[model samples]
Target: MTRGTVILKNGKVFIALGYSNSDSYPSGEIGQMLVKALSNSSDEETVQIIRELIGGLQKDEFSKDCMESLREIGEAFYNKKAATKVGLDDVYGYYYDYSYVYDIKTRKLQIFHFGQLEYSFKKEDFPFLRLVVENDELLYTLSYDTKNKCFKGIDAEVKKVKRMKKAGKSPQYILEIAKSLSERIHYVVDEVYSSDCWPNAVQKGVTFYPSRKRLKFIFKENYGKWNVYIQLPWVRQGLIHNCTSRKAAMNKLIAYLDGNWESFQSGMDLYELYEDCQQKLMNFYNACDQISITKDEFNESVGQIEKEFRGKLIPLEELDYSGWTKAFGPDRAKKEIANWIFMTHRHIFDCIQKA
Candidate 1:
């Protein structure tokens, strides 16, 4: 059986124990067992119990065999440190090897699906979405709730997807699915975190929400300042690759957007912070040697200076979006206004140039 643990940068942990037909056991069974293990708060003891169960998995008992594998993975964790003996402060938490887990604390999504699973994410402040296509291919999207701690699933129609047939390749089709799912996940996270526009009536703080419609880039008037916003959705687990089975045109459109959406957002002034950094970028324009201060250099300098002053200069890492506030000062509320104007002007220029 394949057993693993996924620990997010945040403490949110996902422990997995399952068998794959291609590997140790049936994927479904392993998944079920892993779920069972997580449901138990006392994971340390459960590991030992599972190990004993696995040791007895002989004499043609399928249940015994499956139990044995689960126990083996569990014991692997239990033996590392005896749960009862270890004090709270000295105890290190975890069991088995979890391959993928989403950490809500860190705002990072991780997945370790045995080639069948894929994943993606979206930011609350951006107009476009980001898809995670590094290790696994995405076929469908998955979403989770931070407050209620639940998952939202999308049953996107995949059978009629034309992109797969048009491309005449399975791998490419899977990649398209991964990209689409990633976009969807971004939408979901935004919905949970950002809610309505910046001035959402119900929720006071920042809000994000998922929408089935193409992102209608628009400006919101709130607190005497204009804020820009977009909407998106989240991909559900196991269904990521199902995008290829969708209708052809939509699949192709999603694929195109997956690759080009970031550029589209950039045109909308979504990455204002990056642009500001670029504009404020220092350079030595000397008589002969012109050297550019790379972003890395700028970041290191900011970090060092912040440490010396006991005040952070870079605001991107702050939970309160302090950079915009500090940069705009008295006009903090209208911080996004400048970006909207710039994006709009650029669009007009592009249209005029085309004409």
Candidate 2:
């Protein structure tokens, strides 16, 4: 059982429902306050209580009314694209957006949306809150108790989380929740793009697609600027590649592959790749340093490697099924990840080169 709590940062509040034992965390203070506020609110009037609480916050800590404020934060984060020089989104990190409860007897996963955000496709300042007008539902209530009684509510997200543990499920991983929610929100955002394309219709300045060459890249169009990310196919928590204006997130990822790059390029088949392709990459890495390579240079260099490797290499689409580093231990996962990057990255490049 995982629970959610709203954390206040720099006067802005982010939801952190998945955190357990809040006593040791810095966000515990706000998390405690939020739990207190939610537990004390009128059981029959959750939405109203949230609104009243939000309306009662001070200026410096404006996010007290988190549900309403998230819309504002999202707008502020995304609206930068309209400017000639877009700034970084203020709310960049993962937030606890949803809580899951499991029944020991039934083994069912009940998902609860954390704040007023819709958690679905909707057009408005904040995607989640737009659902308020469409339905008379309360925020932060567990799925089981949501339909139970209007007055019944849990004081802490940990209440359900405890039961989940006994039932043999540990609700951990802050990034896991953040990544899952972010992906869902992105889906909603995508629908808006294909159809509504918020703040304005027919928005065409930004686009995203995979690479079509021998390497994997996420071609990104921000406003009118273009960049690419070296894709780490094994990563599940969202964009593993970080990006700056001049370079993609590949620099860091390339560093992870350094040992293998060295070994393979040194005429040693570290992971049994097709000999021909390894020889080509050996030549490339032996002759060049990736740290100084630019995107166009990378594109130009792909041809020879692609010609040699291409489909001759087998791809490890997924490494584990148990997940949460279950297939292998952490060290083993790390090794496999490095090998996977060397073997599979170019395949993504082959798929999206022209797009």
Can you write out model 2's per-residue Cα lDDT over 1-355, one digit (the tens) per residue?
3334322222233321123322322123322333333344343343333334333433333333433544455423212232213343333333344422222223122223332222221111121222222221122212222111221233243233323233333224322332332222100001111322222212111111111112232435455443433322243222232345323333333333332322212212212344344456556654444245554676567555554343433232232223121322334433554475457546544433533
Candidate that would win on lDDT: 1
lDDT of 1 by residue, 1-355 (tens): 4454322222423233222222222133333333343344553543543443333333245434544543444322222333334342134344333233333344333333332222222122111112122211133233222221122243332321212333334544545654564454432222322244434321122212232323332234444433332221111111112232223323343343444443333222323333343233212112112334544554465444324322222342333322121332213313333344345434433443444
| Best model per TM-score | 1
Stretches of candidate 1 exceeding 4 Å from the true structure: 1-355
TM-score of each: 0.23, 0.19
Residue 225 lDDT (model 1): 37
State residue 263's C-alpha deviation in candidate 1, in Å. Answer: 14
Model 2 regions more than 4 Å off: 1-31, 37-42, 45-49, 59-245, 252-355
Q: Count clashing residue pairs per candidate.
A: 53, 21
